[model samples]
Target: MQHSVQLTYDQNHSLSWGKFVGSVLFAFFGAQIISGLFIGLPFMIYTAGLSDKKTIALYSSLGNTGGTLLQLLILLLFIFKYEPIKKLLLPVLNFQALQKVRTYIYLFLFFGLSIAIHIFIISKLFPHATQEQDLALNLENLNQYKILLILGSAIFVPIFEELIFRGIILQFFQQRFPFWIAAIGSSFIFGIAHIYSLGVMVGAFMMGMFMAVLCKKTNSIIPAMLFHMMNNTLAFLS
Candidate 1:
């Protein structure tokens, strides 16, 4: 079972400046190191050194696999040790609230249209370099492992990111800044953290905005996480 602190204006059971800053810094750095090691550093090492087909393929495969596992481990640790979470990790809400067909439709449209636009823009702008790195491996090389990769990308990563973003960052920002400001700022940070490609960064920013909206409207992270998961699932499948 999950435990949460109920906060109200009257009680205002918030952290002191020192504690708040420390907590935010810890989470931010932890996220950065974990995300960077998994996707960033490995990608850099591979692209910077390996030019051969076999070497590139091997490096890419290892990086993606290892990074995903590391990310998953971090997420599990955060969830399991929720008691130590000094700050709100996610916008608290009931799961049943997100069971509406309308919610599903909204999320489907948002994810589908946004990703489609990103793809279209990428194709138009840089058709030659699209998936240049990934193409070295091809679908043939990723047969059995594809399933695990898909699960990590579509299901696991989205949930993990949303929980970190909409749940933790959003709540913290909302306490200090205007709602829109907090949402946009959090989304911007999210986009920059990926630092993959320009197109991917823009898409990530848009995703952050979408998740923020869900969190703001519902006052909970459940809808955002669900929408994020569904979005990743579609990306993985397609």
Candidate 2:
């Protein structure tokens, strides 16, 4: 009787479909709330009665960096607080996925194809399209916080993104759905997160699809993270 009860207890603790959905929503909205209340609110007060434009710029720069830190903190907390989510991290970070030569070849191939789709297909189709933001120019505008901005946008952004989108969302759905369903479902959400113009949305959708494919082929998220970091680094440099 005790053994059966223990098994039931374990099953309850495992991540449920509802639990996974809740975690994703919590991580996103929790970060937004924390940033607004703690970072933006405080900065607004600090800048009050100060008409100097530099003071306003300084406030924005600091607020932006603080917001990034808070978002990272919130997502990390959400992941570590759950036992099953923690288990997923090992498979996600598994280095064995890189042992096969075909994995490397696939990485290069998928990445190149994604670029081609984004540049040749999407951009050409909608000549006015761009990323949700001109991230490179944003960094330049907030040059006072360039280091923090770069780390936030380029490094930490990809880490949390792969962990959430591919690691959690895609994997969860893939267990019950077909691969195409899982990939498109996750990619759709991923692309929607960066939404603005139609072309930008399509391009992001293609990148998300490629990233999902990379994770599927390698059976890990590490390669996807590397691919994302490399992609973002080049964007900033260009």
Candidate 1 per-residue lDDT over residues 1-238, each given as its tens digit: 9999986552574544455556556555775587776685968675677677656655555566566657657765764465434346533644765767766666677666767766777457655433542354354444336565666565666766776677667776787789999999889988886665665566678888888877766666777877777766665456
Q: RMSD, model 2, all Cα superposed? A: 4.0
Window of ten residues with lowest summed lDDT in model 1:
128-137
Local distance difference test scores for all models: 0.65, 0.76
Mark the regions of model 1 whose C-alpha exceeds 4 Å error after superposition: 1-25, 28-70, 79-87, 90-93, 119-144
TM-score of each: 0.67, 0.82
- Tell me the spans in candidate 2 whose CA falls farther than 4 Å from its real position: 1-13, 47-55, 98-101, 135-140, 143-145
Count backbone clashes in candidate 2.
0
Model 2: colliding residue pairs: none
Residue range with the least summed lDDT across 10 consecutive positions in model 2: 1-10
Most accurate candidate by lDDT: 2
lDDT of 2 by residue, 1-238 (tens): 4554444433554667777777778767776787779887888788786787766767767777677777878778878877777765656677888888988898889888877876778878987665445652355446565665567667887887888888888887776689989999999998888766677677777888998989888888888988887777666665
